[model samples]
Target: MERLDGARGPRSPDRRGLPARGLRRGHPPAHRRERPGDHARDRGLGIALSPGFLSAFVFPSFRRLWIGAFLSSIGTWTQDVALSWLIHTRIGDPFYLGLRTFASELPLVTFMLVGGAQADRVDRRRILLVSQVFQMSMAGALGVLYGLERLGIGAILVIAFLTGLAQSQSAPTYQATLTSLVPHDHIPNAVALNSLQFNLSRAIGPVIAGLLLARVGTGACFAANVLSFVAVIVAIARIELPPVAALGRESLGQSLKAGIRHVVESPILSALTLLGATASLLAFPLITFLPVLAGDVLHTGAPGYSLLLTSLGVGAIAGAVTTAHRGSVPGRGKLMLLAFMACGAATVGAVLSGRQWLAMALLAAAGFSLTTAFSTLNSLVQEHAPNELRGRVLSIFGLAFRGGMPVGSLVAGGLVNAFGAPAVLAAFASALFLIAAAIRLRNARLRAL
Candidate 1:
């Protein structure tokens, strides 16, 4: 049987006598023959290639997931900000706040391989559903505690840990599921769209959380988060995705070894992942210090903290939008290198700024570079990985991206405690940018590939 692209209508059996899967007789494969001018044979040197970027928005499956996830992410951000504030207010310790972040992210580093293996072995939708339910339950518990005024730092930390575990389990499956939603031709666009939704939510979520925090109590933010999960659950329940058959039937350990081997063998993926991991390890931890930046350095309190978070979200949204418009331009190696440099520059700018507005602007720039680099790397990994091993590869990708945060938070917190926020920020920014530049220069294949 020959598979036909559904976008161009039905396909009919040709002289080769292949059976068309879902097409009417007497028609060629939709994707086999291109219309006049469809293929870019020649163009001016400066002309940009447009790869039908709008098709991503038209794909129903991806559209549903994007919208649903966006709504849910807003709630997730609200809950995150509220929880961070709650912990700080209740415990009054940056170390504990750092530890809370560590507890939530540490599981990803440890269990991401297993999670990826599971995503490859089982139905991704089911895995997502299970994880969502677990996360929702935790959110509900926190909401209840908040409503009753019984929420304590310890309870919040424990719940955060559980939610982190669920996130670790869910992320690989979610990443892998994107490929199943659209035709292979649209995978890049789908990935970009996914990033767009996430960044969009990031931009808007903090603003909403800020407003909510200013009006209602932080408990209400948790409650709102509890409601957000419902959108994702319903969206997943309604999606009719392509069947994903199990492949490369091997033990979890063997599969993990295979993924690691593939990464080692593929220098481009390895370089990108390493650069991403290093950047994440150094720069991403500053987020855990935002509350402190607001309280001590800026003297703005919770509302100021909220604005700082929102600014980063807005920057991320801008990055995602830029990527969407660009439509997977090649040379991600250089782009990633530049993004890291931009991130480092932004971080340095942020540290040097004494004014709250200037700090927010710098943080926003950093957010843009951070999201762009991370999202580009994510798409690159997905594009390069074999279909069977994609889940595991992406799980590793998630681990590198997320797992670094906990370690970064701990280091950042300790540095802040010992020296100051500015010193830690400066050290992290300088080290990360320098390392990224060194890596790019050391690996020629990474730049060429």
Candidate 2:
């Protein structure tokens, strides 16, 4: 039988039409095995392409989905900027801004695991479609309310929370769905391209939001975001995904426990997840304290802050491109470790440098290292995870990544408030460097990934 993705079923045949051999004991499954030159693409003319960063686009499903996601992500970032601007201009309180951030992020910490469980149990395509519709509705509501001059802080907070809740469900399902869209060899390229699109959108979206806010106003930004969802919704509706097979009948608590246990039992997964959380806790807070660094240390004010953020986004895009070009290169595990160290070192250099130009340059390097380490870690996790448990595993990763940000920012904020941004940030960067060094020295298995 042909799969929904237009590929032959596993039981179909070998290239010569004979039955495929069954797996032998002590041998890894065919999907899990990696061979040298696996990422290379050979055309009929005998020309070979290495790394094959664009190979995932050979599949119509992945290509359509990627284009849709790219458009939607730009809109999402636009809405984010618009929302923050709306809250700041209207509420005029730092406390409310922080509250909005917290509301928008809390659901990832609380409900992402549940979403992961559902990904394993139900139809992911439907979940994505529903999530897109829900988020689009919320964005529309915000736009309409603001247009009518009836938007309240309470209304904004509630909508933000609901939208975040939907994200908690959709994010893991989206991650889990990538492997289904392409063959195993293309997973790394697909994953890297996914990161590339996100970082690209992250760079482009804010600039668009700034233009919209300056010329047309916040209402236009929100309205644009609502319309952007149509691309992703249409793409999701069109993709012919393989049906999800239920993994188990466990209760939510039990399902979560199983995922946690799987991670705990596997040292590689546990280490990778911990490293990600550590980066979030220590390295990423540099972004949170950037304004302080700009105003206090650099003395560049708002324009400086914008420049610094732009530099970081540029570096992240470069890093994503690098990962896509590398594909499934060996020593990615070691590369990730080095990236952690580089990220920490660059962040420290940026924090210590009083010169604005030097600081921006260092921050760009930090952003590049951070993105490289993250995309590499993500590729490694996807490679090692069994399909049966992939959704749950990825959810744990998402939880660590998303949950760490708020907590880290909160702690880093307090520390900065007490000790000042430069001092606190320097210490955090130092810790991140030491942690990566220690992991590199101790985790031999991880180095082999």
Q: What is the TM-score of each candidate against the true structure?
A: 0.86, 0.82
Q: Rate the local accuracy (lDDT) of all candidates.
A: 0.70, 0.73
Model 1, backbone clash pairs (residues 3+ apart or across chains), number:
1
Q: Candidate 2 residues 55-82, lDDT tens each?
A: 7765545656777787887787777667
Over all chains combined, what TM-score does candidate 1 have?
0.86
lDDT of 2 at 59: 52
Those runs of model 2 whose alpha carbons end farther than 4 Å from true positions after fitting are 1-51, 85-98, 148-153, 248-254, 289-304, 351-356, 419-422
Model 2 per-residue lDDT at 323: 87
Clashing pairs in 1: 12-27
